[model samples]
Target: MARLKTLGSRIKESAGSRVKVVSPGSWRSGMTSSQRGYGYKWQQARERYLRDNPLCVYCERNGRTTAARIVDHIVAHRGDMALFWDETNWQSLCKPCHDSVKQAEEAAGLGG
Candidate 1:
């Protein structure tokens, strides 16, 4: 009887001999909240806001009921610490609504 190789083992064997080509000025990078200098304070604030507003504000407004997974600022902070920390300016949103609709609206408002 033959045993099946695990996916990780197969990937490891194939990756060992591959030569990856990365461009010197490639645009394949992104920053996380912590990488952008948002530390434990930001995380705690987010959690608290989400806890208070467990449902997606956008979805609720549109007559849908969805659980929120992100705490979003009503106005873009644009490096303004005061606005960023304003609890009244926060709203809860699901990942899809935040990523698709809210982001698009923000981008459009920026004339992009």
Candidate 2:
């Protein structure tokens, strides 16, 4: 008699069969403003801003209370060093608010 395979084992076996391969070359990836030169100082500023303002500024403005995990610049710095380090230009925002709403607004030329 043939042995039967369990559902979990069959699923695992099928999943393990597929493999993805990529060719290594000079495929450079773009870096975000924060990753380029904002580095250590930006991290420190973000931490301090979050500590002082734990709630999402955008959500608060919209009458909702959400914890902020990102320190965003009110104005997109666009490689402007002075604007990048301007504390007054910063605001605390949640991941969703920053990535979705804020990004969309900035893309549409609605945000500074």
Candidate 3:
């Protein structure tokens, strides 16, 4: 007979594995987004940036006027607080462009 697997056993398997699994937009440190610097200050900055740059840059390039909903780093910050907070390195992007095109560029090493 096959043995039944409980939730605890499944979690134990993940804990015992050498490779770690992380969800999108989450750090490997397992800290909350606020702890990782997406706290109140970052939220305020993001709101101000989006207000100043209300259209997606990529969409604007294509003659589309999509509303910007995300502020992305032109270069990957990689835990560098200076780069992370640099207003000059920020660009406004629609959710679709940020999630798809920007993510692809970062994955392909073109974002930096």
Candidate 4:
């Protein structure tokens, strides 16, 4: 399994192809200034999503009782924010389950 930093790096590489990533001290060091700002806001929104909707959305949908607290993005945060606050794109998942799901999605042409 890839580590978080490795996964994040790959994600940024794939998603930020057109955008110039430019955060000098960030894992997403290639993010541009404005995009980094947006990432900041998006992270805050993600925190809100996690706080507001704890537990795994997928597990909840399947009627499971997993302890999911990590907020997930249905799309991504490469170079857009039009849907940043849209509830349709948010989800919760436990650490292991989230890792599994993310891996599957990446394998199936989706970014985690």
**RMSD of each predicted structure:** 6.2, 6.9, 6.5, 12.6
State how far residue 28 of model 2 sits from its true place (Å): 12
TM-score of 1: 0.66
lDDT of 4 at 11: 38
Please provide, for model 3 over 66-110, each residue's C-alpha lDDT reduced to its tens digit, 9 standing for 90 to 100: 999999999988778899999999999999999999999988989
Candidate ranking under lDDT, highest first, comes to 3, 2, 1, 4
Lowest-scoring 10 consecutive residues by lDDT in candidate 2? 20-29
Q: What is the lDDT of residue 98 in candidate 2?
A: 96
lDDT of 1 by residue, 26-108 (tens): 33225456644367988888888888889998899999999999988889775567877888878899999999989898878
Tell me which residue pairs clash in candidate 1.
none
Specify the highest-TM-score model's number.
Answer: 3
What is the per-residue lDDT of model 4 for residues 1-112, given as tens digits with 9 covering 90 to 100? 8767534444344554675444467445665555554467767776887777778866877789887767766776544455556678767888876779765886697863
Evaluate residue 57 in candidate 4 and report its C-alpha lDDT on the 0 to 100 scale: 69
Model 2 agreement with the true structure over 1-112: per-residue lDDT tens digits: 9999765544345654756332234122265445655688888888998999999998999999999999888998766778888889899999999999998998799758
- How many clashes does the backbone of model 1 have? 0
| Model 4, global lDDT | 0.67
- Model 4 stretches with alpha carbons more than 4 Å out: 1-29, 32-40, 110-112
Alpha-carbon deviation at 62 in model 4, angstroms: 3.7
Residue 97 displacement in candidate 2 (angstroms): 0.6
Error of 3 at 84 (Å): 0.5
Q: Could you tell me how far off, in angstroms, the CA of residue 65 lies in candidate 4 after the best superposition?
A: 1.5
